[model samples]
Target: MEVAGPSFLLLILLLLAPLSVHSTPPPYLSPAIFAADYDDMLESFRIFVYGARRTFKFKSEAESLFLASLLGSPFVTENPSEAHLFFVPFDGDLSERSVARVVRDIRADLPYWNRTLGADHFYASCDGIGFGSDRNLLELKKNSVQLSCFPGSGGRFVPHKDVALLPAGVAPAGEGEPRGLSSNETIEHLAYARLGAIKDPGLVHRLGGDPGLLIESEPSDRETFERRLAMSEFCLFDYGGDVSWIGDAMRFGCVPVVITDRPIQDLPLIDVLRWQEMAVFVGSGGGAEGVKRALRGMARERVERMRGSCVAASRHFAWNRPPQPLDAFHMVVYQLWLRRHTIRYARRDWS
Candidate 1:
């Protein structure tokens, strides 16, 4: 599972569109795995979720089903997997050591009737389960898994290219927390500044323009942002000499002008967004100048169409089916559930 996440024009130079670069991946598709779609044998076991009082950050899908059953829940499209017990976040309604009891019973293999009664297991959450995650789990996860599919209406929360499909939770800023980089004071703002915006002549000589413009009233407002972005009739996403701010432009609805020298695999959402069709990604580094010219010469409708496609690209990632693999909370549930299976059936004793 993967997920990935922009830009300005100083015009005139826009007439020359920046050079093209490496290629990108295909469009995003939906996830195929689900409990409902599981085989009959795997759907028999009941799960007990211990997310009572919303005390824990993560819980299992099985538990959700169990709690719903306890409430005498009516049919959801009927014949949906009646996978016994499922727990949901109780929000102070259910309390005590209910979770401890469940973990104990599961570890004891209490539900496995001669190894035929225990149900096949599955767990989902933003968090990781340590049970089966023994091998890869040990590998340090250097990067955080960002669930960009659900932006939840946070102000200044620049959305990724595939956020359009998820239900937009209207929780206002600071009301609820999202798994994102914390901002103690300074914003770790990412930018795609062109050489034309710099101060020193040497900088302009080294990077893209006039040094004076960098000194003169810098363009930092929304208007300037939009203008620079709209400069070239067609944009080139110069992922540049580094990780380009392609995600930022998409947040603003500008078709990312991706020009990369490296494989687009380095970026997630590469599979879902159809980066090539929507972006002017240059495959050959030397051909960049030519591609920029072609981009600058492109018709207005083509550019706008690409912009629309960028937004359309967003429709792929939904809540359950996020743009990336998993969220922090879900990861936790998976880890715990695997632990249950291991201790109960696999006879693996982990401290």
Candidate 2:
């Protein structure tokens, strides 16, 4: 009788409990810059420019423009003491000494670096030409968010911590411009080889003589390239130095057929963008057969759906002058925002 009574009571208690769970609020991020003192609205957002001149001019113009765009955004804060994140705007050649000098100076001048061991700090670089060789830079890269054009796996690119920036050429289509979805091109496949040769011999051989595929040894000039891209239904992308052409393909309403053995680290807005919905990924082992299989598997309706998604996702990869919402610049910031959500910084006395 006692056991029966206890079981009855437990059943009643379980029945009365609420089933739904409430979601938590997003974390707040107030990013602060550790740059030189300047009077040009350094305290305000969207107008304040990071007061560092182009020291290492590798892709100086692109670097300069990106820095200006980020610094001019509302995410920046004047007071380091009240900030939740830190940014070190350093541009030039990716020299360990130059980066080290900036890091050392900032760490000495501010307590933020010591607070999180530079975990919350970030540096932006468009040039991936020379930063890989230095051991110190590699270690530094491990600790901070590295925004660059070459955000690949292995080496210093930690996907959760670093950002892969979209190249400058992938700008949004202007008004009256022909979006790629409506193209009437007869070609089914388009491949441009800027690197002279394909890494996979099997893929090279398979696509080399295919009548339906257009394999160009050299890229056409801008106008011709866009025209060819606009005409095709599927554009081929491999593990090249940069995957920026994916953006171009999407802009032209072509579904990208990514053939890579390694992970694609430089995909723009990956945390937010559902890449599988817009592009096709063929593994290295699959070779040309895999690519053809993927294309064959995609029914006309599914291909149309993917093309629609690609058209929708194109704007996220586009760069605007003032940085409109969801554009490339904002997308980078949004990536940083998402990164901020992953981290929980310990409260420290900035006073």
Reference-based TM-score of each model: 0.35, 0.72
Candidate 2 steric clashes:
5
Tens digits of per-residue lDDT, candidate 1, 1-351, equal 111210112222221222221112212232122212211112233344433233333233323322343233121112213333233232222222442233335445444322322223222222222222322221111111212222112221122211111222212222222111123322112123443222334433432332212212235775665444433223333442312223334333345445445544323343333465566654544453444455556676565556455433332221222212222222222222322332243423222
**Runs off by more than 4 Å, candidate 2:** 1-62, 126-139, 151-153, 175-180, 183-202, 218-223, 341-351
lDDT (Cα, tens digit) per residue for candidate 2, span 1-351: 011112333433332332111111111121111011111122222211224444434353345556767666665556554444566776555466777777777767766676666777777766432354454454457777777764354554566777887666575557224264333345445444333335655577787666667777566477877766766778776765445566776776677777777777666666666677778877878767677777777787767666656665676676778776546776676566555523544555442
Clashing pairs in 2: 46-72, 46-73, 56-92, 56-93, 180-252
Residue 79's lDDT within candidate 2 is 59
Whole-model lDDT per candidate: 0.31, 0.58
| Candidate 1 TM-score, C-alpha based | 0.35
Model 2 scores worst on lDDT over the 10 consecutive residues at 30-39
Candidate 2 residue-wise lDDT at 315: 66
